[model samples]
Target: MTLLTPPGVYTPQADTALLAEALRDEAVPPGAQVLDVGTGTGALALAAARRGARVTAVDISWLAVLTARLNARLAGLPVRVVRGNLLAPVAGQAYDLILSNPPYVPARAATPPRHGAARAWDAGHDGRLFVRRICREAPRLLRPGGVLLLVHSALSGPEASLRELRSAGLKAAVAARGFIPFGPVLRARRAWLDAQGLIEETETTEELVVIRAERPV
Candidate 1:
């Protein structure tokens, strides 16, 4: 599907595809309420809408919000696009499924970028700035039996995410995994990752995992 990705908006890629695949596997009941956090191009939200779910997509970037809304319109999908930090705009709302392909790229920045295209992918030094936040806050936005599907590189600590969600009283596990060659961001930071002992000098590929965390029914 052709999506209009404005200059500062994030383009959906492999991680997006992975999460979409997992969403397809989910048994989202008809009329299920779904939330897509960081819905860059509205890919996941549109997918859920196509599956007969009531979808709401959130993004911190206005450009992304506009792009996603345009895509949804073009696709004739009913996705409510909102611009705000993760889970904040949907406060007090509960969803049956929450999808996210948040920023998980380890970067030199101590915190995620406040502006620019880098904000789409540049997380903290450990690459868990947004991932950790999602794990902590998303659970509360879920209804009983709700599920959170999040995709990120293993370098960002999938185990840490599982632990966090479980500690928050959700049953969490790796739902899917894919290995792909390093993208530009990871390639550029290869040296630093190696220095930080996060990756081997010879490593040219990174594994992305879809973490499924479910609130007990």
Candidate 2:
């Protein structure tokens, strides 16, 4: 089936489903102000809004932000989506739920990124740029006892990300985890390696991980 979003934005995909399902069971108080950091296809942001929370969805892509607003209206859910890089649009905003699904493919310059917009899906050389940043800064963005929901790769191993969050003075856990095929960067890099006669195409891809954390009261 064709996805329901404009180009430059990811249509609601499996990752979106994973995030929405996780939020559906959370206890974000009604009318609580919430911030959804990446807001791809308005998945997690819309889910929070559906639960009656006031939501501000932020994204660096103007098209993605527009698509998010369109999704909210289509869903009959009111949401405020802004164009800015990770919290840039929402300074001074404190949220009861600071959620994100950032590009965690590791920070690096890869094959000029096939899709300019798909950069949202590519994290960095180590797949830790946005993921690590999200966790490290989340404590300051959250209210006391407020919760944080972040999704990334378990392939990068949870310890580095978890330790980053803990060092930032937040309590965290692996709220959910699932498998996904290797991202574009990995696939591209592997192809390059093959071209150089490095590795075989038979190598297996890895899965992703989603984690959640809480700011102490």
Candidate 3:
């Protein structure tokens, strides 16, 4: 599905596709309440809506929120697109499924970009800023037996996510993985990544993993 990604909004990429694939493989019962945090281009939310789920998508960027709303309207899907920080707009609500492909690219910046397209991918020095936050908070937003599907590069520490989620009392494990060649952002950060020992100097591929965590019934 083609989406209109305006400037300053994140464009869906391979990580988005990986998360969407995980969403497709999951059992999304009809009328299930679904939430897609960091819904860049609304790709994952649209996927859930296609499966007959009632979907809400959240993004921190106004441009992304507008783009997602437009894309959902154009696709004839009833998706609620809200602009706010991750998972903030839907506070006090529980969902059967929560999805996210948040910013996980390790960067030199101590904090993610406050403005600009880089906010879509530049996480803190270890790339776990948003990932860890999701692990901590998403479980509370999930109904019993609900699942959270999150995608991020292995460089950002998949095991850390699993540990964090399990500590939050959810069962977590890797659901899917794929090796993708370095994209523009990763390519530009190759030197720093290698120096930080996050990647090999000669390595060109990064493994992206979909982590599925379930709130026990």
Candidate 4:
């Protein structure tokens, strides 16, 4: 689906597409309450809405929030678009599903960008900043039997995510996987990644993993 991704707003790409495919495979029934954390153009939120799930999309960027709200209005789909840090806007709410394609690329910076386009992709030195936070909060945000479908780079340590989710009392596993050639972001950071021993010197592609964690009934 086409979306209005203005400058500064993240455009849905491989990670978003991968997570959307994983969402489809889950076959969420109508009326399920779905929360989309770090929604960019509201692509995944709209995808869930199209499947008849009630969707609320959250983003930290004002441009992203506006773009997503506009896109949803244009599509005639109802989505509660809010601007805030991940999951904070929806505190005290529980969802049948929580979806996220947050910033996971390891960056030279010690912390993620507070503003600008890079905020959409650059995580801290070891990445996993948002990934780790989500794993910690997902248990509190999900309803019994609810699932969280999180997509991130293999370089971010999928095992760590699984371990965190499991430790939170949820059943977690890598639900899907795919590989994509380095994008400009990864390509630019290739040297740092190599020096940090996160990727092979000649590695041309990065594996993306979709982790599915469920709160037991």
Candidate 5:
């Protein structure tokens, strides 16, 4: 479970732990194809591989890719770590399960940072940039009966995710939820969040949700 997260690579935090817990609740048969998008340290990917799945981990950051590769190697897990935008590196690939803990924090910037550690969590204004994209693309990459388990802040609009996935012809719903105290990132943006009505004033906890979507057989 320990991973090497360098300066710019995202560290495994509460979201990672929650997603791993959700992964455990799924039945991943041996050699099932699994994709972990935005894999920072290959934590989720390795978790799936440990369940006897063939996992591929993808990240947009070079540091993240290298860190994930090293973690996989160190863990002796057979995870193929690649550096590319979400799902792009694995195009044309179909997976029985897809996992992601993407950037979902609403930020002041008009767009996500092109570089830096913030790229791991500083989503655009509404914080649904990556979430929406995943909802749109996951259905196509999933095999019939395939499942996608995605985790993000409740502040990012879970209803929108469910709606989008349903619109794409998948059965989607929140499978798990948890509350965690604000981390440094969220703590720093508390003022903005309150101003935007994303959170109540003086609120210190945020709800995280694991959205599970299945491609109907």
Candidate 6:
């Protein structure tokens, strides 16, 4: 959850270190167009803006969009935050680089978060709800030879995500990985898996994979 937030929806559980670690060595010119999908707190978008990229951030929740914009202003960064589902509001707009941290949790048997930000944390039953959508639609929004970077839970099947991207005719690769404990809609899965003895309770990492795909000219 954001430290201080308005009385509305919010998506505050994204692992910002994922973006920072992935983008730690990146730089853009003053006018490069950049798109950040599922831009929860606008950290990546704001970072890109600082590097001189014209950033457009997108999120599903109105509160997230507002928070992103507010955060951008707080950082004195120039970014355009949009309130819409994945890729819906930014169609027909091609970008040189697209960044995303999609909701990869599956829609099945997931529990709601007692915490306020849980709404933004969980995906669908398979956790691929947003991942599948983003992989398919991302190529369309990327300019020829543009880059698309998506960070999500590998538990949703990283290979499947690659297939979706390749099906959309894009080349992809695994960029990075990290771990996050149980949160929001994905909470039930741990207990379910533990009951099935699929995972140990002491396991530390869940393989949060970042897949980077690109469209060729």
Q: List residue ranges in candidate 3 displaced over 4 A.
A: none
Poorly placed runs, candidate 6 (over 4 Å): 1-14, 107-116, 180-188, 194-202
**Reference-based lDDT, residue 97, model 1:** 96
lDDT of 2: 0.74
TM-score of each: 0.98, 0.85, 0.97, 0.98, 0.98, 0.83
Between candidates 2 and 4, the lDDT winner: 4
Error of 6 at 160 (Å): 0.6
Q: Least accurate stretch of 10 residues (summed lDDT) in model 6? A: 1-10
lDDT of 2 by residue, 20-132 (tens): 66787689888998899988778788878878999999988777888888888888889999888787677776889887888765434642254576577666556666776
**Model 3, range 97-155, lDDT digits (tens) per residue?**
99999999999999898988799999999999999999999999999999999999999
| Residues 1-217 of candidate 6: C-alpha lDDT, one tens digit per residue | 2333455544344455675567655455689899999887787888788888999999878777888899888888889999887899999998988998766655444552333555555665556667778888889988888888887776677899898998888998888877777654445567755564535776545667878787878
Better of 2 and 4 by TM-score: 4
Candidate 1 lDDT, 177-205, residue by residue in tens: 99999988888888899998899999999
lDDT for every model? 0.93, 0.74, 0.93, 0.94, 0.92, 0.75
Tens digit per residue, CA lDDT, model 5, 87-138: 8888889999999999999999979999887898988999999998999988
lDDT, candidate 3, residue 36? 96
* Cα TM-score of candidate 5: 0.98
Superposed on all Cα atoms, model 1 deviates from the true structure by an RMSD in Å of 0.8
Query: Candidate 6, clashing residue pairs?
Result: 104-127, 105-127, 106-124, 106-125, 106-126, 106-127, 107-124, 107-125, 107-126, 108-125
Better of 5 and 6 by lDDT: 5
Error of 4 at 158 (Å): 0.4
Candidate 4, 1-217: lDDT as tens digits: 8799888988888898899999989969999999999999999999999999999999998889999999999999999999999988999999999999999999999899888889998889878999999999978999999999999999999999999999999999999999999998889888989999999999999999999999999
| Residue 207's lDDT in candidate 3 | 99
